[model samples]
Target: MRKLRELFRLRFEAKLTTRSIAASLGIGNGTVCDYLGRARVAKLTWPLPAELDDDAALTALLFPEDAKAQAERPEPDWARVHAELKKKGVTKLLLWQEYLEAVPGGYQYSRFCERYGRWLATSSVTLRQEHRAGEKCFVDFSGDGVRVVDAVTGEVRVAKLFVAVLGASNLTYVEPVFSEDVATWVGCHVRAFEYFGGVSEVVVPDNLKAGVTRAHRYEPDLNPTYADLARHYGFAILPARPRRC
Candidate 1:
């Protein structure tokens, strides 16, 4: 077990990274992680206890749980488990508990997850994100700008592209404005709602100065004009705050 000794030395003495240790010792990354986890659980250090100086003793000490032959538990119905996971606020731990109730001899949470994960990789498609119809509209500005020419002076200006998307259908409304000032920002929302033929229950906007005057966590400040537009349409303006996304 020369690799095991070197693993301990690299971890506790040299403090090399897992990737570095794996590369240096010619072992797999998973093996390195397993060894490190066992060492931590057994309270092992670089200079192991004198009793485990021998190879056999060290292996036994590190992997006592593996030496005992445990009987296999019943496999979980992963398809049902997968379906349960899609419901809002349902977690793996909760599903595992429910599984244990149905089959008392079923696998533990860790193995249940491992087996379920493998089955999901082979059998399931990625989850679809569903938004409520007319519940919310997400609003943002496109980074790219379009050209605007004044008819009288023939002066050229770069205009910001305002964009709005209805959450359920992803219906989009776009307009090029000279600036993102309060008036233009409010006007864009008005036009967007008119184009959509209805107002969403909530209008989510980026925390720009024209919409969110202050980005405080507890109490965000919305611009008066933007707030007034929301009031007129019977919708609420919700500005995305820092660290919320």
Candidate 2:
């Protein structure tokens, strides 16, 4: 603000060249030019109008992007957007066009998605984890399925992905299995432990059907085979509480 006022003073009141003003103010010549140019375009002069010496007023007069965008753009109804995104044939690009129609100069498509992702991150539920070195390994299935294509038959089948990660170092193991049944689930755990070359103190898993036979608020039932695997591996099994928020 002081620099802005000094720039106008040097140009209009003292009749100094922008380069001279930059040298005197220890600012860039280009910076002085930009500030004075904005002042000129705003029709502001040295000593500025008494009503608008506050920094905010000066900033709005000089750089209006944030204020103008906020005032002119209507905020999206994010909850509605989140719900609508779950429906078929709906996408972020489609939603962004709808948003722009309502507010002609709202955020562009990329910015709209970026902002929505940030909001979802804040509003969504997450299990807070505290991990210690070589203490635990967490495992889960990817919600999306990957397609496996046959080499010559042109056959495609959806594959369920099994993922495991060391809680501390985040060493990851990824494998695609035909199904997330008990056999495949146990096999994946064996492979994951072999890949890490050691077992942690505990294995943490979400309460998927393959691991937890019966879902309960408390005293959930672990599959008998999965329990045997834990017993053989000398590690404890702790299933995550379902529907956590």
Q: Per-residue lDDT of 1-245 in model 2, one digit per residue for the tens? A: 45556667778889999888766666667767776777778888657788786866876777676468557777688889999999877998999999989888789888798667644533433334567999989998976778999999989999988999998899999999889889999999999989999999999899898999877667789999999999998999888888842
**lDDT at 112 for candidate 2?**
91
Any runs in candidate 1 off by more than 4 Å, and if so which?
1-128, 149-154
TM-score of each: 0.46, 0.63
Residue 143 of model 2, lDDT score: 60
RMSD of each: 19.9, 12.7
Residue 174, candidate 2: alpha-carbon lDDT: 94
TM-score of 1: 0.46
Model 2: lDDT of residue 243:
81
List lDDT for all candidates, in order: 0.79, 0.81
